[model samples]
Structure formats: C-alpha cells, structure tokens
Target: MKIKEGFVLHSVGDENVVVAIGKMTKKFRGMIRLNSTGAFIFRQLEKETDEKGIIDALIAEYGIDEQTATTAATTFVSQLKDAGVLDI
Candidate 1:
C-alpha cells in the first residue's frame, strides 16, 4: 500500500505532522501528529510497499525484534487505513 495522493508530511520544529491538500482535503481535513516511529513508518508508506517490507525496515533501522517490528508496522498501517489516508 501507499499513502494516497495529496497527503504530505511536514516537520514542524521538533514535531512531525501529516496534512491533506488538493482533492484529499475533501476526504480528510486537519492534521495528524506523529511521533518519531510514526514519522518513519509514514515515510516508508509514501512509496508502494507491503507490511513485511515495513517490518523489515523497522527491524533494520531500530534493531527491534521481528514481533516488535511487525506490531509497530501493522498498528500504524491499520491506523492510517482507519483514518482513510492510505491507498491499500
């Protein structure tokens, strides 16, 4: 899956946020704040990728275990899906 078009990530001081623009604003409004992990996962989702790919990237980047990475990736993806921000 990938992030739908018109959703952009921006860094605000020490924080990160996702905002919708163009036609996306019709479907989603306001901004979603993200922590460091969420920011990383969001970057990965900017491109076309699957959950396992995200899990592997997380493991490599954070040195976390498989289960930990899986949970993190899965939860974040599910949240984005629920928020209607992902192109699944």
Candidate 2:
C-alpha cells in the first residue's frame, strides 16, 4: 500500500502535516496533523509497503518491541485508511 497521489507531507516547525493537493483536494480537504511517529509511518507509506514492513521498520527505527510496533502501525494504518489517505 501507499499514500494516494495528491497528498503531500510537510514539516512545520516541530510538527508534521499532511495536505491534499491538486485533484485530490476535490475528495479531501483540510490537513492531518501527525506526531513524529505518525510522520515516520507516513513517510514509509509514501512508498509501497505492507503492515509487516511497517512494523519491522518501526521496530528497527525506534528499537521498540514487536507488540508495540505492531499496535502502533496497525492503528495508524487504520486511521489513514478511514481518512481515505491510503492506496491499499
């Protein structure tokens, strides 16, 4: 899965924001603010990846346990999906 076209991630100060652009603005409006972890996951999704890939990357990047990484990745992906931001 990947982030759909037309959505871009930008860093504002110490925060990360996702916004719709061009034709995507027709479907999605406003911005999605994300914390650092969310921004990391979003960056991973900018390319093609799956849940396991995300979990593994999260674990490697943060040195977190498997369970914690799995939970975070799953929850974040679900949120993005519900928000119509994922290509999967």
Candidate 3:
C-alpha cells in the first residue's frame, strides 16, 4: 500500500503526521492523522512498493523480530486502509 497523492507529511512535536491538502478552491487541511509508528510504516510503504519489502525495512530499522514487525506493519496498513489513504 502507498500513501495517496495530495498528502503532505509533517512533524508535530515528537510525532510524524500526514495532512491531506485540499485541491482547487477548497481550503487546505488535514484529512487524516497518524501516530509516529504509523507514519514510519507509511514512509516505508511509500518507498518499498511491496509488503515484503516493508517488513524487511521495518526489521532493519527497528531491530525488531520479523513476526513483531509484520504484526505492527499489518496493523498500520489496516489503519491506512480504513482511512482511505492507502493505494494498494
């Protein structure tokens, strides 16, 4: 899954955030929110272009076991799906 276009990322304090910018005459605003972990996973998905690659990257970056990383990535993916932000 990948983040949809028209979305911009920002850092709010210690958390990484995703804000959807409205198009045309609509006012710019955030349409979805994600926590730091979710943002990290989203960023990986944006780069890797596949689930397996995302899992591998997560393991390498976080030093977590494969199972743990897979579970976390799955959950984060679900959240993005539910929010209509995923392009899978």
Best candidate (score: TM-score)? 2
Local distance difference test, candidate 2:
0.98
RMSD per model, one decimal:
0.7, 0.6, 2.7
Q: How many backbone clashes does candidate 3 have?
A: 0
How well is each residue in 7-87 modelled by candidate 2, as lDDT tens digits? Answer: 999999998999999999998889999999999999999999999999999999999999999999999999999999999
Model 2, which residues run further than 4 Å from truth? Answer: none
**Winning model by lDDT:** 2
Q: Model 1: how far is 35 from its true place, Å?
A: 0.5
lDDT against the true structure, each candidate? 0.95, 0.98, 0.73
TM-score of 2: 0.97
TM-score of 3: 0.80
The residue pairs that clash in candidate 3, if any, are none
Off by over 4 Å in 1: none
Pick out the ten consecutive residues of candidate 1 with the lowest summed lDDT. Answer: 21-30
Model 3 poorest 10 in a row by lDDT: 24-33
Tens digit of lDDT per residue, candidate 3, span 1-88? 5777766677877767777665611543554566767777877766537777778888898899999988988877888777767778
